[model samples]
Target: MSVRVFVVGIGSGDPGHLTGEAVAALNAVDVFLVADKRAATRDLVTLRAELCAAVITHDRYRFVEVPDPERGPDAERDSTAYAGAVRDWHTERARRHAEAVTREVGDDGTVGLLVWGDPSLYDSTLRVVETIGDLLGAEGVTLEVTVVPGISSVSLLAARHRVALNRVGRPVHITTGRRLVGEYDDALGDVVVMLDGDLACAGLVETHPDLEIFWGAQLGLYDEALVRGPLREVLPEIRRRRDAVRAARGWVMDTYLLRPGTGR
Candidate 1:
């Protein structure tokens, strides 16, 4: 019998974000592989369990914890170090994930990985699952994977801000916080930035002072925070509010769109 894995996107932070398909997948799961990330992410894991309780009709399913590996302090400071750390971490996670599957579930059992936001985005769960599949192949077992899509933080940001992501006929550039400055261009029209823990736009305050920004933090959560206005005028407020939300909630996820020529 083949192993079944469902990669379900649960959307950003809200149980209400689960679609009908995601709900169905939740019920189908026999075991949910949850990552015990860190102290700051404890709430995140709780949120998943809460989501499952709120959605699934049966209590037969259970969670199996995958002890996540640390990437080291310097991983965030340097690009090369960060890449290396992430690769090593994923390799280790794959091993642990495979071991957990082998020990807990039978070959025909169903596993669910609840991913935050869309799997096709910056998330690595899909890639890690691919590695898990390879490892399971040793026992002549194959994985039958199913993916259920969820709304991304970028989509939630645009919805909350009530703005179109792009201007009339122009394309919007999507990039991470680290690469935004280099990718920022008037030709791109609207640039959507994500995975930016440092508020990288702050660096563009002087150079692109008049640029309009529609920013949202913890999108869809009860305490969601949003900032909109000139990049220079509202940036400090964004940073302050962002820090406050992170302090109160142990973590924060934010995304923004940079528009040229004043508020599109």
Candidate 2:
């Protein structure tokens, strides 16, 4: 018996953010694999409960903490080591997830994984699935896959800030904070950066201090916070707030967008 998989994105941390179809698919899955950075971040579980809205109980819900492959034993906060370590970690996680699927699904069930945001976005759940699929195929296990889309950090950021993704007729660039730091490029339209470890804006500011940045933290939830202004002025406050919230809550998932000075 082969196992099929469905990966659902839970969207930031809000159960309400889940689309109707996503909720239906989530409830129908035979096994739900939840990947949390730490078991402490119960946001996914909580979101499930909230979205279900009727005291739903999943006999097959399995919470798996993948230990964020991005941070390893020497995982420094947002360091290069952290990045590489995560790649290695995800490889391991996919292997373990494959094992879990084999056991629980018994080679004939649908295993579902709830991703934090849109799977097509920065979320690595898809990559994990790919790795696991390859391993399973090598081991002579067949598999099929499906991905349920959910709101992304960028969409949530735009909603929280009450701003449109792009101006009237402008194109938008969506990239990571690291990329922004590495390449000091600007857009004539709008620029949105995600997966930023609090470095993109700062890096942009040293050279283009006047660039306007709209930052949002924990978007779509009650603890949500947002800041907007010139990068130089808002960068420090964003860092402070980002740090303070992470320390206070033990985890954070944020997304921000930087718009070049088009005087709009």
lDDT tens per residue, model 1, 198-253: 88888787787778889998888778999998888888899899999999998898
Query: Which ranges of candidate 2 are over 4 A from the true structure?
Result: 39-70, 73-86, 262-264
Using all chains and alpha carbons, the TM-scores for the candidates as numbered come to 0.95, 0.84
Worst 10 residues of 1 by lDDT: 70-79
Q: Which candidate is the best by lDDT?
A: 1
User: Any idea what lDDT model 1 has?
Assistant: 0.88
* List of clashing residue pairs for candidate 2: 69-86, 70-86
Best by TM-score: 1
Model 1 stretches with alpha carbons more than 4 Å out:
74-77
Distance (Å) between predicted and true CA of 183, model 1?
Answer: 2.7
**Could you tell me how far off, in angstroms, the CA of residue 207 lies in candidate 2 after the best superposition?**
1.7
Q: Measured by TM-score, how close is model 2 to the native structure?
A: 0.84
